[model samples]
Target: MKIAFYGSSLLSSYWNGAATYYRGILKQLAARGHEICFYEPDAFDRQQHRDIDPPDWARVVVYDATPEALTKVMDEAADADVVVKASGVGVFDAELLDGVMRRAAPHALRIFWDVDAAATLDEMRADPDHPVRAALPGLDMVLTYGGGDPVVDAYCGMGARRCIPVYNALDPDSHLPVAPDPRFACDLAFLGNRLPDREARVEEYFLKAAALLPDRSFLIGGNGWESKAMPANVRHRGHVYTAEHNAFNCTPLAVLNVARDSMAQIGFSPATRVFEAAGAAACLITDAWEGIEMFLTPDKEVLVARDGQDVADHLSTLTADRARTIGEAARARVLREHSYALRGAQVDAILRDAAAARAADLPEMERA
Candidate 1:
């Protein structure tokens, strides 16, 4: 299948947190012989801060963030076997959604792949005339990076033909245990672009904990936090490049995964960093959210914190041996059950089954 994927930058993780999610899943889809061409708009200074060169698995088309450029890509994408307009392209998202629904060939599978399903759903609900709400009936399927049953039922209820959660997973080939680098060495490290919905959680779960453990070292690696004041013990390394993520994950005694407000409230929505941290065998501590047991075993593979106090409590008792034990267990669990190979195959089956179902329906309609 020739897949045309319109998304945020695949070559940069600058302000775009979904970069690895795209690379991980798409790479496996390509491994299964599905040709992929990623269309990304040049915006948000992402091109200026490329984390990776164009990868072999997907041919990336970098276009201007203009209406004309969007139109050109939409025309080219219409011919693909699969036309996907992933959410959060950071430019012309509504138009892209409309394009995927209206421009794709009737035979082509049209997917609105929502990387941030929880938030997207929230927006769509508040604004009834959102492009996604309008496009749901016409789309072939809605695939989310995460947002289990709640998201599926919501989209289906909103007239989507099909909705599936393709949870984020590790790319073992691309991410694995690397020797710890000193630059990232800390007791706890977090790597996420600071955003409105997530900033308070970061402060509560990460920064507050940093203050509690005044002796422990803390590192923050992401954009938009340079100006944000932090505790004395915390160090901010604004925008750690994707290349250094392994080191960033490995060097920390433990890594924390903070979900955006919607994701935490929605539950079953694991951030991509959770798997990335697990891939590098970093002991994981995540904010309390529903359905984590579906992915990793709590207390054994991961630590769940309800608040800043819980975060501090966990770190205070966490010895080096315990951290290592938890990290190893988390890594093993994810590698066995949560790798992108599995995610890709899951998506492949979903696409195939949907196509087959459509074919079956076609003959019946013709007979009618």
Candidate 2:
């Protein structure tokens, strides 16, 4: 099958958080013998800070962030077997959604793959005039990065024909254990760009934890956080690229996962970093969110924290051997049940079934 995916940057993880999810899923789809053409905009200096070159698995089209370029790409993608318009393209998102649905072939499966379903749903709910809300009924399926049952229910309630949660998973090859690097060694580390929705939680969960343990080292990575005030113990390494993720995960005694406000409140939406850190066998400390148990066994495979105090307590008492034990256990669990190969197969089956159903619904003469 030829899948044309219009999403955030696939060649860069600069300011784009969805890059990992796109690469993991689309690369796996390509590995399953599907042709994938990823369309991403040249915006936010992502092109200038690319972490990867054009990959062999998928064809990447880096188009300009202009109406003309968008129209051209839309026309170019009309022949794909499946058309996907993902959330948070950072450029022409609504137009891309409208264009995909408008340009897709009658039999092609049109998917609105929401990388940030919780936030997107919040937008739609708050603004009835949101473009995605208007496009819901036309989409063949709504796929999410996470947000389990709640996302599915919300999308269906909002008039989606079908909604599925294609949660994040491990790409073992892309993110596996690596030798610890001194540059990333710390008591606890976090790597996420600063954003309005997530900044407060980062403060509450990460910065406050650093403050609580004054003598411990805490590493902060990702862009747009240089100017943000932080505890004296926190070290800001702006925008660690994907290639260094393994070291970033492996070297830390425990890596913290703090979901944005919406995701924390909505629950069940795990960030892509969760799987990456776990895949690299990092001890993960995630903010308390519902449905985490569905992914990782809390207290054994992961450490769940309700506030800064819990994080501080976990780190204060954590032994090197204990952290290693938890990390290894987490890796073993994800390796057993959450690899991208498994996720890709799941996605392939879903797309194929949807395609088959579409064919079955056609008229006898049209089927030919």
Candidate 3:
């Protein structure tokens, strides 16, 4: 299958949070003998700080976010077996959605892949004129990054033909246990962008934890957090590149997973960071969210923290051997069931079934 994706940057994680998800899924798909072409806009200085080169399996096209580029992308997508317009492209998203919708072949499986399903759906509900709402009924399927049953149900309610949650998973090839980098060595570390919806939770779970454990070292990595007043015990490194993720995860005694308010409420939505950290054999302390048990066993594979106090308590009591045991367990679980190879197979099956169903319906419609 030839799949064309119009998503955020796959070569840069600068401000593109979906970079890991896009890269992992497409790389696996390409490995499985599918042709993949990724189209990303040259926005946000992403081209200036290209983190990783595109692998041989897929073609990466970076273009100006202009009408001419849209025309070219549309022409390329029209011939694909599947065309995906993902959320949070950060430039002319609505125009890209419209272009894909207009150019996709009748048999093509057009997908609205929502990386931030909770936030997207929330906005759609509040505003009837949202572009996604307009594009929903026309697309063949709606796929999500991690939102579970609730996200699927919401999309169906909003008039999607079919909706599926393709949650984030591990990619052993990219994320593996490596020797810790001395620069990021810390007791607890967190890596996430400073988005409005997640700032409060980061404050509650991470910053407060740092204050409580004044003697322990903590590190923060991500963009847009330069001016925030962090605790003295915590060190902030702005915009850690994708290449440094494994090192960042491996350096910490424990990595923190703080969910955004929307993601926490929607449940079952684990961001790509969770899989990346666990794959690097880092003991994880995540804020309580729904459906986490399905991915990792709490108190065994991963630790659950209710608030800053819980994080502090976990840090205060955890022995080095115990932390290593938990990290190992989590890594084993992800490698067994949550690799991108497995996820690629799942998506392949879904697209095949969707194509078959559309074919079956075409005959009946022709007779009518």
- Model 3 spans > 4 angstroms off: 363-368
RMSD values for the candidates in order, in angstroms, are 2.0, 1.0, 2.0
In model 1, residue pairs whose N, Cα or C atoms come closer than 3 Å (at least 3 residues apart or on different chains), thus clashing, are: 222-239
Q: What TM-score do all the candidates reach, one by one?
A: 0.96, 0.98, 0.96
Per-residue lDDT tens digits for candidate 2, residues 1-368, read 99999988999999898888888888899988999999999999999999999999999999999999999999976788899999999888888999878998777888999988999999899999899999988888999988888889999999999999988899999999999999998999999999999999999999999999999999999988999999999999998999999999999899999999989998888898999999999999999999999889998999999999999999999999999999999999999998888889999999999999999997777555
Roughly what TM-score does model 2 have, to 2 decimal places? 0.98
lDDT of 3 by residue, 42-129 (tens): 9889998888887788899998888888788878888888899999998889989998878877767789999999999999999999
The clash tally of candidate 3 reads: 1
Candidate 1, superposed: residue stretches over 4 Å from native: 362-368
In candidate 2, the residue pairs with backbone N, CA or C atoms under 3 Å apart (3 or more residues apart, or in different chains) clash, namely: none
Among all windows of 10 consecutive residues in model 1, the one with the lowest summed lDDT is 359-368
Model 2 bad stretches (over 4 Å): 364-368
Cand. 1 Cα-lDDT? 0.90
* Per-residue lDDT over 1-368 for candidate 1, one digit per residue giving the tens place of the 0 to 100 score: 88999999899988898999999988988988899999999999999999889988889999999989889988887678789999999899998888766877666788899999888889988998998999888888899988889999999988898898999999997778999999998999988888999999999999999999999999998888989999999999988887888899999889999999999998998888899889998999999999999999999999999999999999999999999999899999999999999999998888778777766666654423
- Tell me, by TM-score, which candidate is best: 2
